[model samples]
Target: MTVVAPPTLAPPPPPGAYKDPKASAVASRAWRWLWLPLLILVLVIAGASVVFIVDLDSSDTGTLNPHSYRPDGGNALRVLTEQYGTPVDTPSTSADALKAGLGGDVTLLIPDTAPLSVRTIQSLKALPPSTRVVLLAPDRGALHVLFPDLDFGDFPATSPVAPNCDAPEAKAAGSIDFDGAGYLPKTIHAAHVTSCYQGGLLLVSDSTGPEFALLGDANLLTNEHLTGYGHAALGINLLSTHSRVEWLYLDQPESASSEGGDGSQALFPPWVDAASLYLILAGVLVALWQARRLGVPVPEPLPVVVRSAETVEGRARLYRRAGARKLAAESLRGGALARITPALGLGADPDPRALIIALAQRSGRTTQEIHRLLYSPPPTDDQGLLALATELDRLVDDYLTQLTIGRAGADQGNNPEGPQQ
Candidate 1:
């Protein structure tokens, strides 16, 4: 009997992304081994994309979590859009547009009601003198809380540029003439913006040459400000005076690997966010391994997941113990065919004679007969069943050997994962 290779077709593309018939690969004697690597690849991809979206694992950079704000949406993209009714553009982003927004442009950024970080404060302070300034950051670290109920009369009416406000911080902030005198710049969206939160410091600085406006907190830029209840208008109003004003938005990127959190006192110390991932992986693996051992439900037994192979193995063992070889052989043949038909391009209900004819036509098989070798009666005894299993085994080996050559050809850069086997 001479064995020949089957017809070669173009290799299939990736599965799931593009559902190909090839993805439902035909199985054989050693076919189960391939799924182990496939399963591992799937697990790795799922774990990486879903889990590391924000809580990344890298030592160099930090994550800029868009969703971590006190409110649901306080990320840089939303911040720029809601504030200016436009996409983001900043000194760092589009420097060419700088001259357009300068020269009598005034813009304000209030971190008052929200928590304002020291870095945020320094960045805001770095604006030009012509730009207006308002220091509304309260104790929350970012300007999140704005004083609404507080009366103007109750305000100290003194220069708040002392230790608390940006007064002393101005020198370090490197503002031009911020150490000198200047008048308060008014904004169109003041009352509406102010109504949302408490008041912070009102600063007047140069945004560009001849441009000026206010800077302070409606609440203050806090990490905890909720959506639809923010003082975004106040920031816009501060910038409204500019004939052509641009908000110098400082946005944190979304996929950073490192960031600061409550890690100092975290229970897991060095691995704050990674603990949950490990626990889930361990649990899933344990469940799969112990699925059969606890297949028959008992009182207080944990859950498990049984793969098709394990289920088959369990049934085979039971049949052997009961001395039912014929039944066992029938099951074994059915399982083996279930894997092979798809692999060899024979339909699910392939007639053994037709399969032989097709194989002969496609791969030039000459005298290899698969009738008694494939669809014989179930074994009547232990020896017969073992013989049937052995026949099934050889058929599987031949099919796989042919499949390996096909795979090798497909992988010469013309295909991705070789021919679907």
Candidate 2:
């Protein structure tokens, strides 16, 4: 008996089912080589981050803090003063410095006043007359805030220059790092402003505010240059003359007006956060507009019909490609059993034991053997799966033939008038 599959037309599977086996193999191979590059990229980024942090901590830039061990830091000064029984207190903000330097003899030392705001400068200027305020490299804005009449002027190259006149700190250091910008007062307040460098004074003391000392250059205060010439002596005499030193390391201000001249642009840049929000909102709206359903789908007839033989061949190829021999074997056995059960006059949901018993009795085969063939573990390979499918078909066809012959013989017996033509 022959079991031939007829032509059958059915809808194609969903798009996801049509994956190419070659493409999957290529993707797996690509990942094998690609992971190394990704790892290298990550390592490169990490190395760059480490270098940036190191560069930021370097003392060549103007950053003075006792906590920092960088070349520009005041760690040496801080340690020296502590040894001499003078403790240095470092404050981050202007308000904190004022509160710390409330005593009349306290010296408020500002390493870099470029970061100070108009508000902080005003607050610093309001300190007591007895409390000395030391400023290093005060810019135009700072000079304007501290000394309203003083103007920035062109100065000669910094050199080891004498005090030339009697100022106690300058005379003590003898020669110092005086190479920097100078201040030119609109009106010569001779008693108040004392010029030390050349044309403009390296150190200035204004009478309007506290005993404010304005030094031209900041390099002299750094850890690298502190030991050069009279730098250390100058720094110590200038800062540690008082009992306590209030070190104010004013970083960039938080408020907009303190940074950019234009308040609106500094506070809220038009192209940054605001633009990003608008872009995100626009993208969401576009997605919603495109995704909205217009109407229900209409069913349409397929353009071409695919034969069952071709479909079966395609499915077999797919199963082999996926290494699905076991799945293929199970499907074939199930199909054979479905056809055979009905031929034996059994219901669709007949018990498996009963069906096996009926098949065994009719074919004169052992119940165990029939059960093993009908409901056994799936085949391990493609050759084994093909053999199982052929065996199932032969067994089912033979049983069906026997059942047909038995029905014919029973009809002849009931009529008793011989076989009807």
lDDT of 1 by residue, 200-308 (tens): 3343223232222223322222333322222333333443444433433334321211112332344456674588779999999998988745456567744887788
Worst 10 residues of 2 by lDDT: 1-10
Stretches > 4 Å off in candidate 2: 1-61, 152-158, 185-191, 199-208, 256-421
Where model 1 places Cα greater than 4 Å from the true spot, the runs are 1-26, 44-120, 123-126, 134-201, 204-236, 244-374, 377-383, 386-421
| RMSD values, in order shown | 20.6, 12.1
Best-matching candidate per TM-score: 2
- In order, what lDDT does every prediction score? 0.42, 0.70
